[model samples]
Target: MDESAIRTQLNDAGYALVQVEPRLQGLGSTIRPDVLAWAADNDGVLVPWAVVEVKHRQVAGHSAALRQLATIRDQLGTVDHYVVIDGEWFRADRGLRTATPISGPVSPANGADGVLQDVSLATSLIQERLWNAANRRRHDGQRLDSLELFADLLPGSLSGELVARSGHTVRADRDVLWRAGRRALTAFTSQDKNTDLFVSHPAIARAVAELAGDAISGTVLDPFCGTGEFLWAAADRAVAASRSVELVGVDFSSQMIEIASSLASAAPVPARAIQGNAYSELPTDVDLVLSSPPLGLRLPTQHELLNGTSTKDGDLASIDVAIRSLRSGGRAVLQISPGVTFRANGEAYRQFLAENVRVAALIGCPRGTVPGTGTGSVLLVIDKLPPTKTFVSQLGEDWEDQLSSGGAAITAAVAHLDDKTAKAT
Candidate 1:
């Protein structure tokens, strides 16, 4: 984990380090404290502050560990808070002492960087708790709910949304829910959305596509239109522009079409969802095409799709056909396995895209962005706009911090192009 980034965010937020673990001494000892940072302020007189020890690890099962932390706290007289940061893959309570339950829970719905996001959220929550606690005895009844406090932060409409789209009763303030939703757009995995019937992280998909220049003026087609997610995202962008999208969705499963059509009817904008052979029956003359094609892992036979049989032929071919069918100047943004970026077999396709179309940009999504999937998958933003500007902005100096925002890279890429164009002129 990038500790420097975490320190940067904390320092900027008015936190100062009082001491770190290595300074306190203890390595290879049963308790390995990877992080030790603290904040304190003293007026003309000296004031006391708290000490925090951070333990970072991957995997799960931390009950015994927390018990160990409790023992350490007892040995060390004055300690404020002890925290444990674990990877998202780990089960709860596997790192920190079970005593201080990580108060602010930032689910994967927010981002796989939940562990890091949890840290930021934890800081704010600690302050809020202290502030509320000071007033708790004096206050009367029914304080402002979190949603009501930060109503402005709420994104889109919040009425139809549930805390967990899977029908879990975990309720949250509307503001928290909104932030959670935005995270969902970027962080949700296919598994996380498996139970979602209508609402999924549609905004992230739409935002990424729009940032890559998807629009309604062009014919936007979705190749692997699983329940018409990308099509609906495109439609939302179009509707926001006071126009309707000329959208078409193709799915290999009739069952998916049925569910997608029903979902679209309730969408903010109308879309056409159809059942067809995604790889074989894609419509031509599309101006902009976007898809999160099935990786074919859970399909009847993974080998069938990868090897490409005469009957099934495979969706990859369908995607290729979609690209070929694009109008001379059109572009397609396809989500593919990260292996596509470096795989030797894809060198031909890469060359084809670079020579024929402008290989506009390659965007890498965070790990676990599409859960239940393996390590290498990304959203490939290919355009016919020529190799103009390739924006690749650093998310932040905090290399360890989970990405809070995107478009920074896109902006950088665009700026890079502009510089080149200016130089040429």
Candidate 2:
């Protein structure tokens, strides 16, 4: 069997959570075991339980896999580490130079009680219902996508209302459904391949919130808010900073607006999501614009916010919506494609932006960080104040390290922006 098949087997055996290619750091470099499993602690919190490295029979031997597991053991400290060779599980020695054979099914304790594991199961179950709904409902001669189906399902499910459409009843219990729905949204995925949910990376969303500063109190807006992840993160940030902040998200998709609205209200901070075309009108009262707008897509000509802007489809057009919406001295932290950042296209608009907006900072992201997009990205931090010299840094895969209070990248970027803001003021 393949590595993925092995992971599934491990998960079935009682590992609450099983993941492949999990992002982890070893003593000095990255170490991605063939499979990683988690189990619940006393508090029902999911923690790393084991790392399984598979040495494929076709490809190689156990020595290399053993060495990698040894590194993980050294760093993670006593988390069970094992290597699978020829479909046999072997417990690795501390140094990994030696190992002993283990019994079959090396699953961790606590099968499904972990909070995250429960949530994952809930997501899977809910997703199954959504898929069934997709099979049932038809929209404009096409079935609604997974996200759209989720939006269609949430309200009725939450209200204890069931839909008897034409010939079928969507059986949903309020307690079981909405609770699962809320948790499911935390890591929701669309099974429908063609649908595009313009969501932001969680790490970048957290960074943007952190960069909003402790003094911030006015409105924070996400123009293309998908699922309200950024707003939720901002809410947490606001609570942490002890600031009274208003959060708003605008999306052209009504389904998105509905889901985002529910998500925002589900969190601690007060927030709202409105259905509006950002191209037509973005709220002008926004003090901070934190968004990851649709990349590589062109807005219709009339929606272009600035004069002399390029007609090309890229982040520049969506950024226009974000910048135009910003209040004076306001800040915008947005994701930009490399093409736009490098002036490969939209040079005219880039020039306009440079001349008019304060390009405060740029954070380069690692590959596969942004979901759905196969490419690495850059976070462009701009202010509505006068243009100034910019702060630039490349971020590692460990977002918490780079974006936290004392992290070099965030610290330097915040310092540069503050210095410029002070000078501008």
Candidate 3:
């Protein structure tokens, strides 16, 4: 079925919000399920209510279409699913349980026009296209060099090959790429999907950026900046703070640096990414630092950057680097493992922290905050100035809501830090 017919049937069946041409997952190849929907009078804060697959009246392969709908129904774990063929509605839910034929109502409601604009989904669609094109080329024996596919698909760098999904190379949307660039290029370049650790939630990036920007201003650096999400958030936050900020992102991955550089170049601030060992790239003049560096890493040599504190722990070393990189009164917002925060063996480090480190706040994040992983994590907001009181709050399962809301723990922590800064000044 056409886009309008699909929308009409969904509206007839009571779906108000719809997303078209979504790269519905858990399938062999890309499957365009036509429209995904939420109930009428209930965009309901964007909770999806049903999945629909629309077929044109004269569409062929009736058996394959039903299989597709059944797979999507099972994949999404949805109770309501439909295979609308030739204007007839067939429910695919029973197929998941038994050999039941597709069943449902033949009806039509009020629906909106065009596709729903979602940053996350739009970026995923781009990601799928880039991956499919690259995979096709790779399968065709095209040995890519470094970030060949990424370099080409980027704005102004589109060689047409990477942008061509099926037939001809079409116009690529630079805006969608910019918004969807939260994930590393490795997510598409890798032999498999990126590990959860590489893909962090954009909400966390925004929260950390706000925390850092609200506290300090001169220059913001993310040492392990993958795809520059933290820096992107920081630079975007700079617009409202009315500050002409400088952003610097460093990473060992060349692909990450290339993509980060491309994304940062379009920012309203002076932003860029440096490719090198992040530990060696920390500058002393930076005013603020924020990042979710790699977890569970170990260094061959001990690090002593955070006011002469020495330790071989990888993340600890990263934290120390962020601390030392700050100016005297500069601050940093970082994500560190929960175990490092409280350990019987860490009493010596605790003493060191009490004497040397000036922690400002500790906002514990809910599980899955690290993305694609089960590892527990928390945000550590600190100042390099002097010993100070630290605000503390633990987020429940509704971490995203708490992080985004104005009255949340992150906002309160910023207030505490601001108050502390005022008193010292």
Candidate-wise lDDT, in order: 0.45, 0.68, 0.65
Q: Enumerate residue pairs that collide in model 2.
A: none
For model 1, the local distance difference test gives 0.45
Winning model by TM-score: 3
Evaluate candidate 1 by giving its C-alpha RMSD to the native, one decimal. 17.3
**Distance from true location, Cα of 255 in model 2, Å:** 1.1
Q: By TM-score, how accurate is candidate 3? A: 0.65
lDDT of 1 by residue, 1-425 (tens): 34454444334433333223332332236654343333222212111122233445554345544555555545442233334454211223323444345432222112111111222222233233333533553485545333222222222223333221111222224334333333332232232334332222354365445643533556778777765666766665676677645677777766566545554544555557888866546687878888776553222422222223322223345446557557766767766666566766555555555555556556666544444444434556556555543433323233213222344555544444334242211
Evaluated with lDDT, which candidate comes out highest? 2
By summed lDDT, the worst window of 10 consecutive residues in model 3 runs over 158-167
Point out the higher-scoring one by TM-score: 1 or 3: 3
TM-scores, in order shown?
A: 0.46, 0.60, 0.65
lDDT of 3 by residue, 309-381 (tens): 5677777777778877888778889987776688564566666665665777788887868876677688998
- Candidates 1 and 2 compared: the better one by lDDT is 2
